[model samples]
Target: MKKSIVLISLIGLMIACSGEKKESTEETQITEEEVQNIEQSAQEIDAVIDSSIQEIDTLQNEIDDLLKDI
Candidate 1:
């Protein structure tokens, strides 16, 4: 679910950054810095996801150990 959500959000962001952007009353464009920032943000998100999965696995192992004792 988290991956799906992140994928969707990243896809949307990529689409938004892919083409010329113009506001209704003004001209606005996606900059190189914005794209770079998005890339960094995605990396950070992946790191958080990795850590979260690891924590969940650790907790699950602890739970399984307890179940085995009982």
Candidate 2:
């Protein structure tokens, strides 16, 4: 009786483990709209970064000019 109980418990555990593996192995599918949206977000981020770099360069040049005058 104990042996049967242990065997059944082990089988139940195995079934639970297999179910989890199937869920974990499933592939995620992204739609084309999602891809386009990601690309647009990336482009927006790049534009922001470019403008920030230009601003920093302008600030650095002004600082250098002020130092030269002093």
List RMSD in Å for every model shown: 19.1, 5.6
Tens digits of per-residue lDDT for model 2, 1-70: 9999999999999888886444566789999999999999999999999999999999999999999999
Model 2 spans > 4 angstroms off: 1-25
Spell out the clash pairs found in candidate 1: none
What is the TM-score of each predicted model, taking all chains together?
Answer: 0.62, 0.64
lDDT of 1 at 19: 94
- After superposition, the stretches of candidate 1 with alpha carbons farther than 4 Å from their true spots are 1-25
| lDDT for each residue of candidate 1 in 1-70, tens digit (9 for 90 to 100) | 9999999999999998999876598668899999999999999999999999999999999999999999
**Clash count, candidate 1:** 0
| Best model number under TM-score | 2
Q: What is the C-alpha lDDT of each candidate?
A: 0.97, 0.95
